[model samples]
Target: MKNKIIGVCPNCGANVVEREKGWFCENRECRFVLWKDNAFFKRLGKRLDYHVADKLLRDGRVRLKDCKSAKGKTYNATVLLSCEADGRSKFSLEFEGGC
Candidate 1:
């Protein structure tokens, strides 16, 4: 099956396509990618779905509701997407009230 075009790579402005294991940049030399089974989201008891991925690519951040913590508590926060020097995606969480 052909991979679906999800978004544009923030790194190289190439098409970002969804693959079996992850979303990848069409430009082979670009390292931009978003893994389907992203470890960061897994730790938050969440999965990185297309909706979230789209927002991250388009806006550089996404507001997530009802994220589960390791302690089983739920909270809302914004997920920020940043690219490393090598084009790998990195994520960070921002809570309300500056906490």
Candidate 2:
């Protein structure tokens, strides 16, 4: 099997590598945890379950919202996956109103 390095993690900002065991973050302290589970998903009206979230995380695909960095900057991010050491998740968003 062949693995590809996709660069650093977006959540923790640590290096991410594709290995035989699948993609794993280089940061030992980091779990590379993706989006929130049941409560969060329900609150956000996401049509996914806990099990699905886990699968998506493993597949490097999860969404994040209302994210604030360590620098105190807040952003409305639509991440396609949780591929960061900073603990950010990936998602696609829909804008209902004018910007």
Candidate 3:
């Protein structure tokens, strides 16, 4: 089966590999990792957070205003995220790229 590679690393411009532990960027300088847990959730925001930023920084290849990687490629997009109805919580990437 073709593994659905979601996004790209925003740190070192490398592809992020999904592991049982979490996501990992295949870059020496970009050692980005994320897991699903309490502490992980605590370090995030309602709509978006550090985890989201980390994901974007480690697997989000974009070039927009509300985006992080603005030096790679220019694409119109509006990413939507969802998570527990709380303030400090890790959210999931719901929407990505429509324009």
TM-score of the candidate numbered 1? 0.93
Q: How are the candidates ranked when ordered by lDDT, highest leading?
A: 1, 2, 3
Candidate topping lDDT = 1
Report, for all candidates in order, the number of backbone clashes. 0, 18, 2
Per-residue accuracy of model 1 over 1-99 as CA lDDT, tens digit each: 888999999988999999889899999998999999999999888899899899999999999889999889999999999999999899999999893
Error of 2 at 83 (Å): 7.3
Model 3, range 11-80, lDDT digits (tens) per residue? 4456656555555556655554444332423323222334454445443321223332335443334333
Looking at model 3, the pairs that clash are: 8-59, 9-58
| Residue 65 in model 3: lDDT | 39
TM-score of 3: 0.37
All candidates' TM-scores? 0.93, 0.34, 0.37
State the lDDT of candidate 2 residue by residue for 6-98, as single tens digits: 456656767656554335567887666333343344444454544444445455555455555456565454434433434444455433243
- Residue 89, candidate 2: how far off, in angstroms? 5.0
